[model samples]
Target: MNNQQWTGWSSGAQQAEQHYLVEPRYLAGGGNLHHVADFLRASGWSDKSKTGGPLVFDSPDKSVRIGYDPYTQPGGWTISANPADGQEAWHATFTRQTPVEIVAGFTDALTRPRSAHAPNAWGPLQEQRWQTEQGQHFTAMSPDGGAWLQYHQSQPGQALWWAGARNEHGRIWDASFTASTPMHLIESFSAALADPQQVMRPRGHVPPSTRIRTTSVSVRPDELSAWQQARVTAARAATWARASWATTRPRHTTATGPHTQAGGRTRR
Candidate 1:
């Protein structure tokens, strides 16, 4: 291990605040970890150097140089990014937002300007407990399909780590690493009290209210029941009400009452 202190990025010694292009952590291959590198390869950039150099992702203009070397760290890799040339060369670490954050950080670095828009504070949308090659794994995603987080353990009640990813639309994405968490398969169910399916689910038939329609209430004259009479009267009233509502657009109106039958009997 290089005993040299890795003081990430500091503006100055007085009130020095360290910033990182990509925060370094114990290598945990997360996200499409090599996406940036893949982009480089597609751009006709080759990783084959005559002198066997560190893995590097450089912009076409050769401004941004993100280099990673596994031998630099004792049990991991060292990822660093800087500009090859320019007065603003010192702005190497300004990419604090889109820094490569996986155990696969020995990967690519992007130079796209970070979005000025604020990131959404995500709440869990979906969860699944499944078995993986390693052990039992759990995963959760956001409702918008914009973020994903996962956890895995070696055995039934063993420890695990979190790996996460968030994206800005389809372009830039981020990974997650939460340390100092003591959760079992799921130690405590203490949660924020929280928290595609293009399949069309069958819904009960709903009669449209705003849409005017004709409803036939057929009944035999000799065997008319109170309910049948009520339906026939209601159908006629509805027809009239719809006409009145459509033509006059009445501000206030009462639904006309049902007719009363003979012998002081009310039509139900």
Candidate 2:
């Protein structure tokens, strides 16, 4: 953790004073999409988009496809996976307004090898002492009362899990996860929501008209929160690697594969 303190607005903070704490990405609508894109590219996903069309990347084994389109209706980013070895396929879509960090949670988990044990979705929030209503249909609210997540056991074919943020004015943002969406992805998202690390935002840009009043802290113009700094560092590394690869690799390298959709989970 960076000991150097800086000021920013936080709905999750205990007071309107300077401290390190991560604000929910749903509270405001800004994040760097390039960071996640570069991460996927660096991890061996092959680009499959046309020069002027929406960006598309396919996993090396062609089991997954990720897409980003500014103008796509309903959602601008999408991920679809279909494994050939009888594993379930899953699809997820994110609205253009969905914060990149939230989406990155899923992508980050996706790239990692599957864990030997099943993931527990509620554990992350529980660790933070979030309030929960236990039942067939489960729900939990953040300690600050600004964000919440729920599981609709009865709504099997529908979106089984839904999460959102709100303030005095109204709902700021929301997302849903389908039944087929992997549990690990849901767990990763919950972990991100519960992460204690703080995000850096300009004082003037404080967001969502919070239910819990926020305090301001001082930050140097050149300083950035740890999360922000990590994204910047990843983007820089990806860019430098691409430039180096272009200069060193032969121009004739080519890849080709067929894309197929099979049975799996659906998410939104």
**All predictions: root-mean-square deviation over Cα?**
31.6, 10.9
TM-score of 1: 0.24
Residue-level lDDT of model 1, residues 1-268, one tens digit each, is 1122223222233432121111111111122224344444444344542345556655545544544444453212222334343322222111122323232221321322223544222222223221122226555544433334455555666533443333432322233222222121012111210121111001121121222122222222222233234434544454467456769753343356555433553322
lDDT of 2 by residue, 1-268 (tens): 2344443322343333333333554565545566577677766678888888888988767888989888656647788888567657777776665666777777767765677888998999999888999877789999878788899777546546788777778766667776777898889988877766545445445554534334345444334444456655674576578568869865332255344335433431
Question: What is each predicted model's overall lDDT from 0 to 1?
Answer: 0.31, 0.68
Instruction: Give the distance in Å from residue 122's predicted Cα in candidate 1 to where it truly belongs.
Output: 9.8
The candidate maximizing TM-score is: 2
Stretches > 4 Å off in candidate 2: 1-22, 49-53, 154-159, 202-208, 211-268
